[model samples]
Target: MGIGSWFGFGDKSARASEPQPEPAHTVPTSQDLLDAVDRVEQQAKDGKAPGMVQSRLGRVARTVRDTVPRLDTLGSGSPQAYNVMATATNYLPDAIGGYLRLPRQWADSRPVDRGKTPLMILIDQLDLLGATMDKVFDAVCRADAEALVVHGRFLEEKFGAAAGGGDLIIGSTPVPPMPATDPSGPSPLTPPPGRTA
Candidate 1:
């Protein structure tokens, strides 16, 4: 055997045969995403994030909550779905956590990048996440809305009438029309001889 082999470094086949490590980043489950969001909220509250920061965090959290249920609609392979997962599990928590790690007075008051404080940077990140989540939510909901429209069109075509404008039918019976009103009579709405209403 070669010197390298003696040192356990020369056999490519052996290296290939060894078990590999799991991926560093696996897709999170829905519950995992929600737990992350809850952690972020608790951190924000405990860390005393500013009102502005809290507001932004709340927006991102709400959007994440709204989007999680519709992840399937976004398709497991879609980037939008990935964004939802990452925003909850990584982007949002990281942004808030990083800011919380800093001295509050300094993080809020001192500029760290291009004249922006850590607070400002966190806000920007939160805003971006919020907007992305909003878009994903809209995209998911749009699919259902479009289906409703398409179904309505199909229904209209099958019934041969506008949705609410034609004679009503239930199973095999047509609903009767209301009797005509007499033009010369006192209005039906006028109480018999106005006793106090």
Candidate 2:
């Protein structure tokens, strides 16, 4: 007897499977985050008790004062900026890889080989930007003739211990050459003039 017959199976297609329902919880939107930022900025501006009591509050207030105007002018709605923001948010690995290429491209485009120029690794989102930014920063520091200019918050958060007074200012270090790989299966070797292998 077949296994199905032994199990007392009668109808081949009697019952129908029900489709699973998606979860009802809504994820926080970008506008929600922006609204939160606005609230924080307002609190800072109004000197609200608990939030305004911190020692660094004044510094944060000043930064907000400086950044708001620029942020308004830049307007997160621009296509180019939105594209970059989306790339950084959704596909950080590709973003970092592409970002690293900028300095190399700039260096290559220069007329003379003046060694590596100073590199400014601007990490916009401290919380959202992944650890790969750190790796890229390290790579830039290790490359020959490259100086790093990192954002203050990222420097403090990531390399705080190594960050002496404030900010991480890494000098250039020599990068070891990468071993070359043969593109084709095997390198073609020309036989010696008279002898054949």
Candidate 3:
């Protein structure tokens, strides 16, 4: 007998009657992937010589260009895109860390808004932002902040309707805590060598 049936907890006959839970589904938004990529690129750029970081960033960009088509198709019909996108996302942190020379934690702690060039971009379909691609392009051109411009074409091609209304939310820097102090008493030095009983 099955464990459920052996304990007299459930009817053996009802075992087949119970419905199985459905697997959870997650969609990878274009903004999320782009932001991840940009973050990695930023770290690489910051840490390495401009030439080295540029070369690596170029490679990553090429990889994105190559993979995005496949991702879009998969996004339309497969549950595997989540895993694929996640795998792609993972590479950025490593690339960033390698280029930066510092630990990933250090790079992550730096402010994303302080760049002369935009630190990250969110690419998606025009409809996602409820704006025209031209308008976005224009905004990027006019914006005072250094901006990473996410390509709308890529978003439209890969994510279809799902890429609509996407925005990149930059991850926050984590603040390190101050060391704890003893609340009970003054320094032991104050008592000085066992004076008296």
Task: Give Cα-based local distance difference scores for all models.
Answer: 0.87, 0.38, 0.48
The TM-score of candidate 2 is: 0.18
Residue range 40-145, candidate 3, lDDT tens digits: 6666566653463456455545455344444544435443444436534764465345435644454444444445122221111111222322233333344423
Q: Model 2, residue 160: what's the lDDT?
A: 57
Q: In lDDT terms, how accurate is model 1?
A: 0.87
Q: Which ranges in model 1 have alpha carbons more than 4 Å from their true place?
A: 1-19, 23-26, 156-162, 169-197
lDDT of 3: 0.48
Give TM per candidate: 0.73, 0.18, 0.31
Output the worst ten-in-a-row residue range by lDDT, candidate 2: 118-127
- For each candidate, how many residue pairs have backbone atoms clashing (under 3 Å)? 0, 0, 3
Q: Point out the higher-scoring one by lDDT: 1 or 3.
A: 1
* Candidate 2 lDDT score at position 106: 58
Model 2 misses residue 192 by how many Å? Answer: 61
Model 3 alpha-carbon drift over 4 Å, by segment = 1-27, 75-84, 102-197
Model 3 residue 97 CA deviation in Å: 1.1
lDDT of 2 by residue, 1-197 (tens): 35675465744453224355878955334454344444544543453322212223333333333333333233446443343233333433332333344554553344432342212232322222323333333333343222233445556678654532333435765554455656864445756468688
Ranking by TM-score: 1, 3, 2
